[model samples]
Target: MRIEPAFLFDLDGTLVDSVYQHVLAWKTALDAESIELSVWRIHRKIGMSGGLFTNQLLRETEVEIDPERIERLRRAHAEAYQRYASGIRPLPGARKLLAWFTEAAIPWAIATGGRMETAAVNLAALDVELTKIPVITRDHVRYAKPDPDLFLAAAERLDAPIEGAVVIGDSI
Candidate 1:
Protein backbone atom coordinates (compact mmCIF):
# COMPACT_ATOMS: atom_id res chain seq x y z
CA MET A 1 0.00 0.00 0.00
CA ARG A 2 1.23 3.48 -0.86
CA ILE A 3 1.70 5.80 2.06
CA GLU A 4 -0.38 8.94 2.12
CA PRO A 5 1.21 12.34 2.16
CA ALA A 6 1.14 14.49 5.29
CA PHE A 7 -0.15 18.04 5.05
CA LEU A 8 2.05 20.41 7.03
CA PHE A 9 0.60 23.85 7.61
CA ASP A 10 1.88 27.14 8.92
CA LEU A 11 -0.33 28.70 11.58
CA ASP A 12 -0.37 32.46 11.04
CA GLY A 13 -0.84 33.05 7.34
CA THR A 14 -1.80 29.69 5.91
CA LEU A 15 -4.50 28.39 8.22
CA VAL A 16 -5.88 31.68 9.51
CA ASP A 17 -6.21 35.36 8.82
CA SER A 18 -4.34 36.18 12.04
CA VAL A 19 -1.42 37.98 10.45
CA TYR A 20 -3.00 41.32 11.14
CA GLN A 21 -3.60 40.40 14.75
CA HIS A 22 0.00 39.26 15.05
CA VAL A 23 1.17 42.51 13.58
CA LEU A 24 -0.94 44.33 16.08
CA ALA A 25 0.38 42.20 18.91
CA TRP A 26 3.96 42.87 17.90
CA LYS A 27 3.25 46.50 17.42
CA THR A 28 1.65 46.70 20.81
CA ALA A 29 4.59 44.91 22.34
CA LEU A 30 7.11 47.17 20.70
CA ASP A 31 5.10 50.22 21.54
CA ALA A 32 5.50 49.43 25.21
CA GLU A 33 9.21 49.64 24.51
CA SER A 34 8.71 53.00 22.77
CA ILE A 35 9.67 51.39 19.46
CA GLU A 36 7.57 51.90 16.38
CA LEU A 37 7.73 49.68 13.34
CA SER A 38 5.81 49.03 10.15
CA VAL A 39 3.37 46.16 9.92
CA TRP A 40 4.95 45.14 6.64
CA ARG A 41 8.30 44.62 8.36
CA ILE A 42 6.70 42.55 11.10
CA HIS A 43 4.64 40.59 8.58
CA ARG A 44 7.71 39.64 6.63
CA LYS A 45 9.29 37.98 9.69
CA ILE A 46 6.18 36.23 10.96
CA GLY A 47 7.58 32.71 10.85
CA MET A 48 10.58 33.23 13.09
CA SER A 49 10.71 32.54 16.81
CA GLY A 50 9.86 35.42 19.14
CA GLY A 51 13.43 35.98 20.31
CA LEU A 52 14.77 35.80 16.80
CA PHE A 53 11.97 37.98 15.56
CA THR A 54 12.76 40.63 18.14
CA ASN A 55 16.46 40.39 17.48
CA GLN A 56 15.99 40.60 13.77
CA LEU A 57 13.69 43.56 14.06
CA LEU A 58 16.23 45.36 16.23
CA ARG A 59 19.09 44.47 13.92
CA GLU A 60 17.36 45.47 10.71
CA THR A 61 16.38 48.81 12.13
CA GLU A 62 19.63 49.31 14.09
CA VAL A 63 17.68 49.65 17.29
CA GLU A 64 18.88 48.52 20.70
CA ILE A 65 16.67 46.70 23.16
CA ASP A 66 17.54 45.60 26.65
CA PRO A 67 16.95 41.92 27.38
CA GLU A 68 14.62 42.50 30.30
CA ARG A 69 12.76 45.13 28.32
CA ILE A 70 12.19 42.73 25.45
CA GLU A 71 10.77 40.17 27.86
CA ARG A 72 8.42 42.75 29.29
CA LEU A 73 7.39 43.69 25.79
CA ARG A 74 6.62 40.05 25.00
CA ARG A 75 4.42 39.80 28.05
CA ALA A 76 2.60 42.97 27.10
CA HIS A 77 2.03 41.59 23.62
CA ALA A 78 0.61 38.39 25.03
CA GLU A 79 -1.82 40.37 27.12
CA ALA A 80 -2.85 42.42 24.13
CA TYR A 81 -3.32 39.26 22.09
CA GLN A 82 -5.55 37.69 24.73
CA ARG A 83 -7.71 40.77 24.75
CA TYR A 84 -8.37 40.46 21.02
CA ALA A 85 -8.42 36.68 20.78
CA SER A 86 -12.06 36.59 19.75
CA GLY A 87 -11.31 38.39 16.51
CA ILE A 88 -8.92 35.68 15.33
CA ARG A 89 -10.41 33.17 12.90
CA PRO A 90 -9.40 30.65 10.35
CA LEU A 91 -9.10 31.62 6.73
CA PRO A 92 -11.45 30.52 3.96
CA GLY A 93 -11.11 26.84 3.05
CA ALA A 94 -9.05 26.13 6.19
CA ARG A 95 -11.82 24.31 7.99
CA LYS A 96 -12.79 22.53 4.79
CA LEU A 97 -9.21 21.49 4.24
CA LEU A 98 -8.84 20.12 7.74
CA ALA A 99 -12.08 18.23 7.42
CA TRP A 100 -10.95 16.82 4.11
CA PHE A 101 -7.76 15.59 5.74
CA THR A 102 -9.74 14.08 8.57
CA GLU A 103 -12.24 12.33 6.34
CA ALA A 104 -9.52 10.96 4.13
CA ALA A 105 -7.37 9.84 7.07
CA ILE A 106 -4.59 11.97 5.68
CA PRO A 107 -2.14 12.97 8.38
CA TRP A 108 -2.00 16.70 8.99
CA ALA A 109 -0.29 18.99 11.45
CA ILE A 110 0.86 22.53 12.15
CA ALA A 111 4.51 23.55 12.23
CA THR A 112 4.51 27.09 13.47
CA GLY A 113 6.89 29.60 14.97
CA GLY A 114 4.36 30.49 17.63
CA ARG A 115 4.80 29.53 21.26
CA MET A 116 2.77 26.53 22.40
CA GLU A 117 0.47 28.59 24.61
CA THR A 118 -0.05 31.28 22.00
CA ALA A 119 -0.73 28.68 19.34
CA ALA A 120 -3.17 26.99 21.66
CA VAL A 121 -5.00 30.24 22.30
CA ASN A 122 -5.26 31.06 18.60
CA LEU A 123 -6.31 27.54 17.66
CA ALA A 124 -8.91 27.58 20.38
CA ALA A 125 -10.14 30.95 19.13
CA LEU A 126 -10.48 29.39 15.70
CA ASP A 127 -12.37 26.45 17.27
CA VAL A 128 -9.62 24.01 16.39
CA GLU A 129 -8.51 21.25 18.72
CA LEU A 130 -4.81 20.48 18.55
CA THR A 131 -5.35 17.13 20.25
CA LYS A 132 -6.84 15.88 16.97
CA ILE A 133 -3.83 16.99 14.95
CA PRO A 134 -0.06 16.67 15.21
CA VAL A 135 1.56 19.97 16.18
CA ILE A 136 5.22 21.00 16.31
CA THR A 137 5.77 24.42 17.75
CA ARG A 138 8.85 26.38 18.85
CA ASP A 139 9.01 24.40 22.07
CA HIS A 140 9.29 21.12 20.19
CA VAL A 141 11.74 22.10 17.50
CA ARG A 142 15.40 23.05 17.77
CA TYR A 143 15.20 25.32 14.75
CA ALA A 144 12.31 27.15 13.08
CA LYS A 145 11.41 27.69 9.46
CA PRO A 146 12.34 28.64 6.74
CA ASP A 147 15.01 26.14 7.87
CA PRO A 148 12.56 23.17 7.51
CA ASP A 149 13.24 22.04 11.11
CA LEU A 150 9.69 22.60 12.25
CA PHE A 151 8.25 20.79 9.23
CA LEU A 152 10.71 17.94 9.54
CA ALA A 153 10.04 17.78 13.26
CA ALA A 154 6.29 17.56 12.66
CA ALA A 155 6.75 14.73 10.17
CA GLU A 156 8.91 12.86 12.66
CA ARG A 157 6.41 13.33 15.44
CA LEU A 158 3.61 12.10 13.20
CA ASP A 159 5.68 9.08 12.14
CA ALA A 160 5.42 10.38 8.60
CA PRO A 161 8.25 10.51 6.11
CA ILE A 162 9.62 13.89 5.07
CA GLU A 163 9.70 13.08 1.37
CA GLY A 164 6.01 12.18 1.59
CA ALA A 165 5.11 15.46 3.27
CA VAL A 166 4.25 18.77 1.64
CA VAL A 167 4.58 22.05 3.54
CA ILE A 168 1.85 24.60 2.96
CA GLY A 169 2.93 28.07 4.02
CA ASP A 170 2.17 31.57 2.76
CA SER A 171 5.70 32.83 3.17
CA ILE A 172 9.09 31.68 4.32
Candidate 2:
Protein backbone atom coordinates (compact mmCIF):
# COMPACT_ATOMS: atom_id res chain seq x y z
CA MET A 1 0.00 0.00 0.00
CA ARG A 2 1.11 3.51 -0.72
CA ILE A 3 1.95 5.48 2.42
CA GLU A 4 0.57 8.92 3.23
CA PRO A 5 2.39 11.86 1.75
CA ALA A 6 3.09 13.31 5.17
CA PHE A 7 4.04 11.30 8.23
CA LEU A 8 4.05 12.46 11.83
CA PHE A 9 5.53 9.97 14.28
CA ASP A 10 6.00 9.65 18.04
CA LEU A 11 9.60 9.71 19.22
CA ASP A 12 9.79 7.26 22.09
CA GLY A 13 8.15 3.90 21.48
CA THR A 14 7.52 4.58 17.82
CA LEU A 15 11.00 5.45 16.65
CA VAL A 16 13.32 4.49 19.48
CA ASP A 17 13.26 1.66 22.00
CA SER A 18 13.69 4.00 24.98
CA VAL A 19 10.64 2.95 26.95
CA TYR A 20 12.69 0.83 29.33
CA GLN A 21 15.03 3.70 29.97
CA HIS A 22 12.06 5.88 30.83
CA VAL A 23 10.77 3.22 33.23
CA LEU A 24 14.17 2.91 34.83
CA ALA A 25 14.42 6.65 35.27
CA TRP A 26 10.99 6.86 36.87
CA LYS A 27 11.74 3.91 39.14
CA THR A 28 15.04 5.43 40.22
CA ALA A 29 13.45 8.81 40.86
CA LEU A 30 10.59 7.36 42.90
CA ASP A 31 13.00 5.13 44.77
CA ALA A 32 15.05 8.15 45.77
CA GLU A 33 11.91 9.63 47.31
CA SER A 34 11.22 6.34 49.13
CA ILE A 35 8.10 5.89 47.03
CA GLU A 36 7.90 2.38 45.71
CA LEU A 37 6.02 2.35 42.40
CA SER A 38 6.08 -0.53 40.02
CA VAL A 39 7.94 -0.16 36.71
CA TRP A 40 4.96 -1.66 34.91
CA ARG A 41 2.72 1.10 36.20
CA ILE A 42 5.24 3.76 35.24
CA HIS A 43 5.53 2.19 31.79
CA ARG A 44 1.86 2.89 31.23
CA LYS A 45 2.53 6.62 31.67
CA ILE A 46 5.53 6.75 29.40
CA GLY A 47 4.28 8.98 26.60
CA MET A 48 3.33 12.04 28.62
CA SER A 49 5.63 14.81 29.80
CA GLY A 50 7.63 14.18 32.97
CA GLY A 51 5.58 16.54 35.13
CA LEU A 52 2.25 15.33 33.82
CA PHE A 53 3.22 11.69 34.08
CA THR A 54 4.48 12.18 37.62
CA ASN A 55 1.24 13.85 38.62
CA GLN A 56 -0.89 11.12 37.08
CA LEU A 57 1.13 8.34 38.65
CA LEU A 58 1.04 10.02 42.05
CA ARG A 59 -2.70 10.49 41.82
CA GLU A 60 -3.18 6.85 40.89
CA THR A 61 -1.30 5.86 43.99
CA GLU A 62 -3.31 8.32 46.09
CA VAL A 63 -0.08 9.95 47.15
CA GLU A 64 -0.01 13.65 47.97
CA ILE A 65 3.17 14.56 46.18
CA ASP A 66 3.70 18.30 45.87
CA PRO A 67 4.08 19.62 42.34
CA GLU A 68 7.45 21.11 43.26
CA ARG A 69 8.60 17.80 44.65
CA ILE A 70 7.48 16.01 41.54
CA GLU A 71 9.42 18.49 39.43
CA ARG A 72 12.55 17.77 41.48
CA LEU A 73 12.05 14.07 41.03
CA ARG A 74 11.59 14.58 37.31
CA ARG A 75 14.90 16.39 37.13
CA ALA A 76 16.54 13.53 38.93
CA HIS A 77 14.88 11.09 36.54
CA ALA A 78 16.28 12.99 33.60
CA GLU A 79 19.75 12.78 35.12
CA ALA A 80 19.40 9.05 35.71
CA TYR A 81 18.15 8.60 32.15
CA GLN A 82 21.27 10.19 30.74
CA ARG A 83 23.33 7.32 32.13
CA TYR A 84 21.45 4.83 29.93
CA ALA A 85 21.41 7.10 26.91
CA SER A 86 23.88 4.97 25.04
CA GLY A 87 21.51 2.02 25.20
CA ILE A 88 18.93 3.78 23.04
CA ARG A 89 18.31 2.19 19.68
CA PRO A 90 16.06 2.73 16.73
CA LEU A 91 13.12 0.37 16.47
CA PRO A 92 13.19 -2.26 13.76
CA GLY A 93 12.43 -0.79 10.33
CA ALA A 94 12.36 2.79 11.68
CA ARG A 95 15.41 3.87 9.72
CA LYS A 96 14.22 1.99 6.70
CA LEU A 97 10.81 3.63 6.90
CA LEU A 98 12.44 7.05 7.23
CA ALA A 99 14.67 6.34 4.27
CA TRP A 100 11.66 5.24 2.28
CA PHE A 101 9.96 8.54 2.96
CA THR A 102 13.07 10.45 1.95
CA GLU A 103 13.42 8.51 -1.24
CA ALA A 104 9.73 8.84 -2.05
CA ALA A 105 9.83 12.59 -1.49
CA ILE A 106 7.21 12.27 1.23
CA PRO A 107 7.53 14.86 4.00
CA TRP A 108 7.73 13.61 7.57
CA ALA A 109 8.11 15.06 11.04
CA ILE A 110 8.22 14.08 14.71
CA ALA A 111 5.66 15.25 17.29
CA THR A 112 6.68 14.11 20.73
CA GLY A 113 5.70 15.16 24.25
CA GLY A 114 9.31 15.03 25.36
CA ARG A 115 11.21 18.23 26.02
CA MET A 116 13.21 19.46 23.06
CA GLU A 117 16.55 18.94 24.81
CA THR A 118 15.71 15.37 25.76
CA ALA A 119 14.24 14.68 22.32
CA ALA A 120 17.39 15.99 20.67
CA VAL A 121 19.58 13.81 22.87
CA ASN A 122 17.52 10.72 22.07
CA LEU A 123 17.38 11.48 18.36
CA ALA A 124 21.10 12.08 18.28
CA ALA A 125 21.67 8.73 19.95
CA LEU A 126 19.50 7.15 17.25
CA ASP A 127 21.45 9.10 14.57
CA VAL A 128 18.40 10.91 13.24
CA GLU A 129 18.92 14.19 11.38
CA LEU A 130 17.30 17.03 13.32
CA THR A 131 18.06 19.59 10.63
CA LYS A 132 16.44 17.51 7.91
CA ILE A 133 13.17 16.76 9.64
CA PRO A 134 10.76 19.02 11.47
CA VAL A 135 10.37 18.31 15.21
CA ILE A 136 7.44 19.66 17.22
CA THR A 137 8.23 18.78 20.81
CA ARG A 138 6.98 19.89 24.23
CA ASP A 139 8.79 23.21 23.85
CA HIS A 140 6.71 23.93 20.78
CA VAL A 141 3.30 23.37 22.35
CA ARG A 142 1.45 24.26 25.53
CA TYR A 143 -0.38 20.93 25.57
CA ALA A 144 0.75 17.41 24.73
CA LYS A 145 -0.71 14.26 23.20
CA PRO A 146 -4.41 13.27 23.17
CA ASP A 147 -4.88 17.06 22.93
CA PRO A 148 -3.51 17.13 19.34
CA ASP A 149 -1.40 20.23 19.98
CA LEU A 150 1.96 18.65 19.30
CA PHE A 151 0.78 16.83 16.18
CA LEU A 152 -0.98 19.92 14.91
CA ALA A 153 2.14 21.97 15.50
CA ALA A 154 4.24 19.48 13.60
CA ALA A 155 1.87 19.44 10.64
CA GLU A 156 1.83 23.24 10.67
CA ARG A 157 5.61 23.50 10.74
CA LEU A 158 5.93 20.90 8.02
CA ASP A 159 3.37 22.81 5.94
CA ALA A 160 1.39 19.60 5.65
CA PRO A 161 -2.36 19.60 5.91
CA ILE A 162 -3.69 17.69 8.90
CA GLU A 163 -6.22 15.84 6.82
CA GLY A 164 -3.48 14.49 4.60
CA ALA A 165 -0.94 13.89 7.34
CA VAL A 166 -0.69 10.55 9.11
CA VAL A 167 -0.08 10.41 12.85
CA ILE A 168 1.78 7.21 13.72
CA GLY A 169 2.16 6.09 17.28
CA ASP A 170 2.69 2.83 19.14
CA SER A 171 -0.23 3.44 21.45
CA ILE A 172 -3.34 5.56 21.53
Candidate 3:
Protein backbone atom coordinates (compact mmCIF):
# COMPACT_ATOMS: atom_id res chain seq x y z
CA MET A 1 0.00 0.00 0.00
CA ARG A 2 1.23 3.49 -0.85
CA ILE A 3 0.18 6.78 0.69
CA GLU A 4 -0.70 9.53 -1.77
CA PRO A 5 1.39 12.67 -1.70
CA ALA A 6 0.05 16.04 -0.60
CA PHE A 7 0.89 19.42 -2.02
CA LEU A 8 1.21 22.32 0.41
CA PHE A 9 1.24 25.79 -1.09
CA ASP A 10 2.27 29.16 0.24
CA LEU A 11 -0.19 31.97 -0.38
CA ASP A 12 1.60 35.21 -1.09
CA GLY A 13 4.09 35.21 -3.91
CA THR A 14 3.47 31.61 -4.77
CA LEU A 15 -0.24 31.85 -5.49
CA VAL A 16 -0.84 35.59 -5.64
CA ASP A 17 1.45 38.38 -6.72
CA SER A 18 1.23 40.00 -3.30
CA VAL A 19 4.83 39.94 -2.14
CA TYR A 20 5.53 43.54 -3.11
CA GLN A 21 2.22 44.60 -1.66
CA HIS A 22 3.32 43.18 1.68
CA VAL A 23 6.71 44.78 1.29
CA LEU A 24 5.11 48.15 0.65
CA ALA A 25 2.71 47.68 3.50
CA TRP A 26 5.60 47.06 5.86
CA LYS A 27 7.32 50.14 4.47
CA THR A 28 4.22 52.14 5.22
CA ALA A 29 4.07 50.72 8.71
CA LEU A 30 7.70 51.49 9.36
CA ASP A 31 7.31 54.96 7.96
CA ALA A 32 4.25 55.62 10.11
CA GLU A 33 6.29 54.74 13.16
CA SER A 34 9.15 56.98 12.04
CA ILE A 35 11.38 53.94 11.58
CA GLU A 36 13.77 54.46 8.72
CA LEU A 37 14.26 51.04 7.20
CA SER A 38 14.65 50.74 3.43
CA VAL A 39 12.19 48.74 1.34
CA TRP A 40 14.94 46.42 0.12
CA ARG A 41 15.87 45.67 3.69
CA ILE A 42 12.27 44.88 4.54
CA HIS A 43 11.93 42.61 1.49
CA ARG A 44 14.68 40.43 2.82
CA LYS A 45 12.44 39.42 5.72
CA ILE A 46 9.20 38.94 3.78
CA GLY A 47 8.27 35.28 4.36
CA MET A 48 9.16 34.85 8.05
CA SER A 49 7.15 35.08 11.23
CA GLY A 50 6.10 38.64 12.08
CA GLY A 51 7.70 38.47 15.51
CA LEU A 52 10.93 37.36 13.94
CA PHE A 53 10.61 40.01 11.28
CA THR A 54 10.19 42.75 13.87
CA ASN A 55 13.07 41.45 15.92
CA GLN A 56 15.28 41.36 12.84
CA LEU A 57 14.18 44.83 11.87
CA LEU A 58 15.17 46.14 15.26
CA ARG A 59 18.44 44.28 15.18
CA GLU A 60 19.40 45.53 11.74
CA THR A 61 18.26 49.09 12.27
CA GLU A 62 19.30 49.31 15.90
CA VAL A 63 15.91 50.86 16.66
CA GLU A 64 14.38 50.42 20.08
CA ILE A 65 10.74 49.34 19.91
CA ASP A 66 8.32 48.38 22.63
CA PRO A 67 5.61 45.78 22.41
CA GLU A 68 2.97 48.50 21.97
CA ARG A 69 4.82 50.03 19.06
CA ILE A 70 5.26 46.64 17.46
CA GLU A 71 1.54 46.02 17.71
CA ARG A 72 0.84 49.40 16.18
CA LEU A 73 3.16 48.60 13.29
CA ARG A 74 1.36 45.33 12.68
CA ARG A 75 -2.00 47.12 12.65
CA ALA A 76 -0.62 49.75 10.34
CA HIS A 77 0.75 47.11 7.97
CA ALA A 78 -2.60 45.34 7.83
CA GLU A 79 -4.37 48.59 7.03
CA ALA A 80 -1.83 49.50 4.41
CA TYR A 81 -2.06 46.03 2.86
CA GLN A 82 -5.80 46.47 2.47
CA ARG A 83 -5.15 49.58 0.45
CA TYR A 84 -3.03 47.52 -1.95
CA ALA A 85 -5.17 44.40 -1.91
CA SER A 86 -7.27 45.39 -4.88
CA GLY A 87 -4.20 45.31 -7.06
CA ILE A 88 -3.29 41.75 -6.12
CA ARG A 89 -4.01 38.95 -8.58
CA PRO A 90 -3.49 35.22 -8.81
CA LEU A 91 -0.23 34.32 -10.38
CA PRO A 92 -0.50 32.88 -13.87
CA GLY A 93 -1.37 29.18 -13.73
CA ALA A 94 -1.79 29.29 -9.95
CA ARG A 95 -5.54 28.82 -10.01
CA LYS A 96 -5.13 26.31 -12.80
CA LEU A 97 -2.66 24.29 -10.78
CA LEU A 98 -4.96 24.12 -7.78
CA ALA A 99 -7.91 23.26 -9.93
CA TRP A 100 -5.87 20.54 -11.56
CA PHE A 101 -5.08 19.08 -8.17
CA THR A 102 -8.74 19.13 -7.25
CA GLU A 103 -9.67 17.47 -10.52
CA ALA A 104 -7.06 14.80 -9.92
CA ALA A 105 -8.31 14.10 -6.42
CA ILE A 106 -5.07 15.17 -4.87
CA PRO A 107 -4.83 16.49 -1.34
CA TRP A 108 -3.61 20.06 -1.20
CA ALA A 109 -3.69 23.00 1.19
CA ILE A 110 -2.51 26.57 1.53
CA ALA A 111 -0.05 27.54 4.24
CA THR A 112 1.13 31.08 4.57
CA GLY A 113 3.38 33.14 6.79
CA GLY A 114 0.62 35.73 6.97
CA ARG A 115 -2.18 35.74 9.46
CA MET A 116 -5.82 35.36 8.43
CA GLU A 117 -6.11 39.10 8.71
CA THR A 118 -3.86 39.40 5.65
CA ALA A 119 -4.10 35.97 3.99
CA ALA A 120 -7.81 36.59 3.53
CA VAL A 121 -7.03 39.22 0.93
CA ASN A 122 -4.66 37.00 -1.01
CA LEU A 123 -7.10 34.11 -0.91
CA ALA A 124 -9.79 36.37 -2.34
CA ALA A 125 -7.42 37.44 -5.07
CA LEU A 126 -6.68 33.82 -5.84
CA ASP A 127 -10.42 33.15 -5.96
CA VAL A 128 -10.01 30.29 -3.50
CA GLU A 129 -13.17 29.48 -1.60
CA LEU A 130 -12.17 29.09 2.01
CA THR A 131 -15.25 26.95 2.63
CA LYS A 132 -13.76 24.22 0.46
CA ILE A 133 -10.08 24.72 1.10
CA PRO A 134 -7.91 24.02 4.09
CA VAL A 135 -5.83 27.14 4.71
CA ILE A 136 -3.34 27.33 7.57
CA THR A 137 -2.21 30.80 8.46
CA ARG A 138 -0.08 32.30 11.21
CA ASP A 139 -3.22 32.68 13.31
CA HIS A 140 -3.65 28.91 13.25
CA VAL A 141 -0.15 28.03 14.32
CA ARG A 142 2.40 29.08 16.92
CA TYR A 143 4.95 29.86 14.23
CA ALA A 144 4.96 30.59 10.48
CA LYS A 145 7.31 29.85 7.58
CA PRO A 146 10.92 28.70 7.94
CA ASP A 147 9.62 26.82 11.00
CA PRO A 148 7.45 24.11 9.34
CA ASP A 149 4.49 24.78 11.65
CA LEU A 150 2.23 26.18 8.94
CA PHE A 151 2.97 23.32 6.56
CA LEU A 152 2.64 20.83 9.37
CA ALA A 153 -0.75 22.21 10.31
CA ALA A 154 -1.83 22.17 6.68
CA ALA A 155 -0.87 18.51 6.30
CA GLU A 156 -2.80 17.73 9.47
CA ARG A 157 -5.81 19.53 8.05
CA LEU A 158 -5.54 17.45 4.88
CA ASP A 159 -5.06 14.27 6.92
CA ALA A 160 -1.80 13.77 5.06
CA PRO A 161 1.61 12.90 6.37
CA ILE A 162 4.41 15.45 6.28
CA GLU A 163 7.02 12.92 5.22
CA GLY A 164 6.21 13.02 1.50
CA ALA A 165 4.51 16.40 1.17
CA VAL A 166 5.57 18.80 -1.56
CA VAL A 167 5.82 22.42 -0.53
CA ILE A 168 5.39 24.92 -3.34
CA GLY A 169 6.52 28.41 -2.39
CA ASP A 170 8.60 31.27 -3.75
CA SER A 171 10.55 31.64 -0.55
CA ILE A 172 11.46 29.83 2.63
Select the stronger candidate by TM-score from 2 and 3: 3
| RMSD after Cα superposition, model 1 | 1.9
lDDT of 1 by residue, 1-172 (tens): 6767998988887888777777788888887777889889988887677878888898887877679876886678778777777788888888888888889888888888887767877677556676777888888877776578899998998899998999998884
C-alpha RMSD values across all candidates: 1.9, 2.6, 1.0
lDDT of 3 by residue, 37-92 (tens): 88999998898777778878977888886899889988899999999998899999
Pairs in steric clash, model 1: none
CA lDDT of 69 in candidate 1? 73
User: How do the residues 1-172 of candidate 2 rate in per-residue lDDT, one tens digit apiece?
Assistant: 4435688999999999999988998899889987889889999888887768988888898878896888778788888888778888888988888888889988999899888756876788566788888988888898887689988899888887888888999878
Better of 2 and 3 by lDDT: 3
Clashes of 2: 0
> Global CA lDDT of candidate 3, please?
0.89
Q: Ten residues in a row with the worst lDDT in model 3?
A: 47-56
Which of candidates 1 and 2 is the stronger one according to lDDT? 2
The runs of at least 3 residues in candidate 3 whose Cα sits more than 4 Å from the true structure, single-residue gaps closed, are: none
> Between prediction 1 and prediction 3, which has the larger lDDT?
3
